[model samples]
Target: MAVAAGCVVATLTADPSWAVQRPDPRPAAQPAQLSAPARPSNSDLEVVRLDPDPAPPGGTTTVHAFVANLGPETTASPFTITVVLPKGVTAQGPFFPTDCADLGDGHVVRCTFGPGLKEGRSATALVPVLLSPDLQLGTLTGGSVSVFSPDDRNERNNRQSFDIRVVETAAG
Candidate 1:
């Protein structure tokens, strides 16, 4: 076929000193090709709200919960902070005296806030949760508040979800 089309047009018109360039040892602080973290979306993190948004079903609700460790880098040490309770709520403590840990797929009732939390360091947890006057008014969905760490070694820490809302208290 015409000597293979003139040897591919003389090797693509080679003239740049017999071209075969290869000297990009790459290292100008090379670090941009990391696409595997786009699967975690929670709009980042930082939520703490518990105002007078309805609290009277028997009384007692002083939720402070104000966590912040938005981490740009500097939050590695134990790392834990959980709060999942809202189905007739009931969790009052001095912080770290847990005993209702069974979320093995039976809905939810987990409450753990311990060991670590200090990146941007905005801690402020004063949970005195209680709302069980035979609970039957309305609105008490799934409530949640989590923050974990320890991802690969597998000791437990790879849980992050946030959402909490409670309303319905004025039928006394």
Candidate 2:
């Protein structure tokens, strides 16, 4: 190329800045890890509460505990549920919503839920529990069901348990 006197001519080259910036042909930022996700809320996984705080004895009753995924994205991963046995309260059988293992020796019931728990959604297992026929009518404390999750942002709300009371079955 020839430039006239007092005229300036610049050669063009393939430069990154000169290239068409069509919305950054790449993700804003790809996550490095696949297991745990970075979520905006502190509660990525949580176990909200347990139903039937006072369970009746001598009969099989359905008990449900709420597990929540408060993250920004839905995830497909199995989480563990552990129900700490209350004195005189024993599980009649394995929990419903299937695919659960009863760790008989531990006296603690464990259940696995979901390959995917949607964000802001809650799930639970309707566990069948039977109060011991001979259980003295009283409150059993420290009995809780907790959810152990992989990418839970906060661990505070992962467990919920209340005093379990064994009452006489109503004659109906």
Best by lDDT: 2
Tens-digit lDDT track of model 2 for 61-81: 556766878877675456777
Candidate 1 lDDT over 22-121, as tens digits, reads 7779855435546322222221235454442456565556445455655454333433445666666666554433443445532343444443444466
RMSD of 2: 8.7
- Candidate 1: residue 146 lDDT (0-100): 53
What TM-score, computed on C-alpha atoms, does each candidate reach? 0.27, 0.68
Q: lDDT of candidate 2?
A: 0.68
Candidate 1 clashing pairs, residues 3+ apart or interchain: none
Candidate 2 residue-wise lDDT at 119: 83
Each prediction's RMSD to truth = 13.0, 8.7
Off by over 4 Å in 2: 1-43, 53-55
Candidate 2 structure, TM-score to reference: 0.68
